[model samples]
Target chain A: MIEEREIHKEYEIKENPLVDVAAYLFLEDIADKQGAAGMNNYLISLATSLAKSMPEEEYKTWEDFVESLEKGESIISTFESVRAKTNHCMVTHKCPFERGWKEYTKRIGDFARVHKEVADYYNSTVKPGVNDTQCIICQTFRAAAAERITVAKKRLKYAQLAAVAPDGSKKIAPDEWKPILLEKAGVTNTDLNMVLRNNACIWILY
Target chain B: MLDVALVSLIQDMSEKAGVEGTIQYWERVGESLAMRMGKEAYMGWPSFNVALREGRTAYSIEGDVTPLTDLAVTDVDGDVVGYIYALKTCVFEPTMQRVRYSVGDVPQADAAVAEEYNNSVKDTAICNFCVIHQKFREEVAKNITVADQPLECVQLADRGFKGETKIARDSLKRIGINPEYVRSLLRNYACVFAILMKGARLKGEEEVEE
Candidate 1:
């Protein structure tokens, strides 16, 4: 605590109210600008410690303003997150490597404890702000679900044109044309059913 | 020696195909082939590369910073010697106006917390995590203004950590940069300093974290 004070002192930043107001007012100015609106909330929170000096009552909810002030939880920067990968470390700690309950009753208790840990962590951690909106897991799953539902709705139009399969299950995709095109083009990574259903409305290959 | 052969080949092709358009067309192809062949092979060729030319906006310099947008740098023979590209970092900015990007702000990117709260909102122009898309880049330079000064060109990399690139190092080898010091691009992900884009009129309500 003393070291932190000295460090702030070295920069000539004492606990002055005028300085605190001016700083948050400055944040309010930047935050109000339309050009800067696209920046992710989590990215801005990296500098949230500066707002720790901000007094309560200046915001809609003092609890929320104080909650955002807690930093260091998100260590990964935007550049580091080049690829989509989930960070599931909270639950991992509860489940130790190469270790599980061997006894029957103990196993039941362990499973319940792990589930509680995850629920508690998410409750305590997910900030009540825009950061929650850009949650990677929520964004990815929403996009996938939206794509699936969209395709399912559109598939209704083609059900009358095609006959029901041998097992009486409606064919979601026509297998004849895509396979021939895939073979001729020598493309195999993507499934025609998946791509045509989810990717785009118009189909053209170049 | 190589220039004579290239000229003769172009002349021969120009005679067979309509000279008006095909000459310039084939010339571009020939220059690209010569550039891919490397500088050594085109010793007697005329150089036409503007790898470090000045006075052009980002729009004119490379067209678009978006991927697949090619900016060809060629020699006098019109052979492509290098390619100057707008790095993907420009993906975040709005392509509204005429702008350009420069390299060298390494320390800014690493600065987590800034000391001394100046209480001046004008200083937060640091686009550490800002995104300027294609729309922002096409903004007219005259539209941008800050503190009554014409903010014709706001460089994101200028305020924060600098972006570095190796396109000049590998392509323009005669620039005498140490190859080891330059970056080796992987999947075209080079550290670009910032993209200068066209400025647009602001309705004046924005936040760094939206």
Candidate 2:
């Protein structure tokens, strides 16, 4: 616990109420655009945390905290759309393996932004002032499920290759085929087992 | 190379030959050859699994059908080396995309006929596998010193671990890797990781068990 405190002290927290409000507003915008209506509860919790952190002179009520957020300056940075970001990375990278990593990060970042945006909108707009706290749980679940499905799809392709030798045993070297699967799938042995254990027969046919 | 046009012709002919005709064709063609050649002798083998290591449409067949044309053996430069006989007793099934041919036959038979049949069977496997069958054939012809002996199932089964391992290995190799280190890593740490990860997930279940 002492270590944790020291670690925390090493990185001082930003205490600006407007900064907190700006973060929430950004999340609200993300939620609105990404069809993520499940982050409202988390957004509320975040708002509450910010409110608590606020000096007593800044605001006493939660409503006052939200109002302060609405008044904050709107700064739009150079954020690229998910599709554009992915395409740019895929086209520009010399190595396909590296490109795939960039593309995945960009996609995850975009989805995270979308989740925040949806949460903010729900908290500030729909059911405004309602204190229900289940929205955050649902958003987390949606994100988790989406990630699993994407991973499952990629792993399934590797399994398909294993079933059929690429060069046709008479044709290609069987030894060569195995390495190709790893390179293309971006999977290590550890990842492959996780995929196989999680997926198995279901991944192939289904 | 078997002409795609010829395959279309045979398929059209066989379909017109009707269901009974198809069966009779197999029985007379596929079965008779299987009987006459006594599968072991290679005259009448019905089917055999051709081996492939990597790529799409890996496994294929030999003597799966009769050739529609004669074959003239040639080198990579198209120079004639030796001629292989072609036979018509083998039937081609385009729908199945298989060449029903004999694995072995009487040596005295026309080399041109045997060559055609070999070509047809090959074309069928290629079509079925939806791969460039020639490339596979060339690779096999080069790597496989003996086409006369088919790959035994026992041998294939011994290599079964390869199904999963190869996929992992191939993916790594594409980046110019010798994944022996990865295998060593897997051997050293994979099970430990699996248990640790699973223990975390099943922590609640285990608590209930406790």
Candidate 3:
């Protein structure tokens, strides 16, 4: 019964920091990667309200509690600094998201420091080629490249489209498609030609 | 991006609570947001940004992506440069408590009822304590910079700064915070904390190749 009560209490209308952190992280991720404004708004509102409910004992006032929330941004900024050392931001000009969960959170400096030991162990004991050593630079580069690929895929959505002719002639194929598709699909629609008229037509000398 | 201390604290707490799984859950949510937002927003890890360069239509930054927690493009000329979109969550309802001692018409002693009440009290105490942490986490996520830098009056004054802490400290003093604490804060928070989180992501990439 105590266990049940505890479980129920946890599930009940009470603030669970774990849940809060999870929710905050969730919405922030949404706000950042997905631009889910609504979800972000919901998470932010919950977080703000929870912050407001702090017992005055833990903080001098609601304002002080709210201020700590401000510190979260600072924490984020610090992470950026850490990411910077790895060139995760500048080279990518963005947050590194092309990586798996592990790649994003694994501190590269730490990885490099520890990886060599593991690599050495494998190299000294394992068979050649079987004990392939992992290099930090390669890992970091791989992560960056992966992130680049992801970015490229996202950017490709806005890529300009062009038409190529099989016979190298200026011709709107029976390939003329729907206007909406045409408008949304290719290079500027103004670039398209309605007809292939020639000046060879008989003209009155004016 | 997140401050090392805060991340350490959160990481510690998460470990204590056996909630590392939560990180993956949030990451999934972040990924989902990235997919959905598409070109409307930049879906950098740990944060998001709204700026889009001309002729570029993607959520991924072509160059180094600023963490959502940084204010790089948001603050210019010692003033917040751009609009900040905010999101948050609401508090859930509290648990209920039952009072009584009537079972099979056998009157229970007040001592037994007092024990139950005491346990309830203890449970509520624990619940309150847990709530504080939850609240803290939620608030922390709100108003985070595109990078993970904390928003302070001093930092606010140096929004678009491109110099060392010395320049920032002087600027903060000009804005009214004591020069001493400003320097201290800059050293502790800016140098150590923000350095790791807000530091440029792409600057040293070329050097690493060597």
Best by DockQ: 3
TM-score of every prediction relative to native: 0.18, 0.15, 0.17
Candidate 1, what DockQ? 0.01
Better of 2 and 3 by lDDT: 3
| Candidate 1 docking classification | incorrect
Q: Between prediction 1 and prediction 3, which has the larger lDDT?
A: 3
The alpha-carbon deviation from the true structure for residue B74 of candidate 2, after best TM-score superposition, in angstroms, is 39
CA displacement after TM-score superposition, residue B183 of candidate 1 (Å): 20
Residue B151 accuracy (lDDT) in model 3: 29
| lDDT (10s digit) by residue, model 3, range A1-206 | 45744553343323322332333344344345444333323332332222222221133443432233233221111111111211121111122111212222221111122223333343344211111112211222222222222221231111111211111222132234435434443323443332112210000000
Report the poorest 10 consecutive residues by lDDT, candidate 3 chain B.
B95-104
Per-residue lDDT for A88-127 in model 1, tens only? Answer: 1010111110111111122112222222232233324432
Docking class of 3: incorrect
Q: Compute the lDDT of residue B86 as modeled in candidate 1.
A: 35
Candidate 1 segments exceeding 4 Å error: A1-120, A124-206, B1-82, B87-210
TM-score of 1: 0.18
Across residues A78-180, which tens digit of lDDT does each residue of candidate 2 receive?
0000111111110011111122223223322222345334534654664321112223322222222222221212311112222111111111113545465
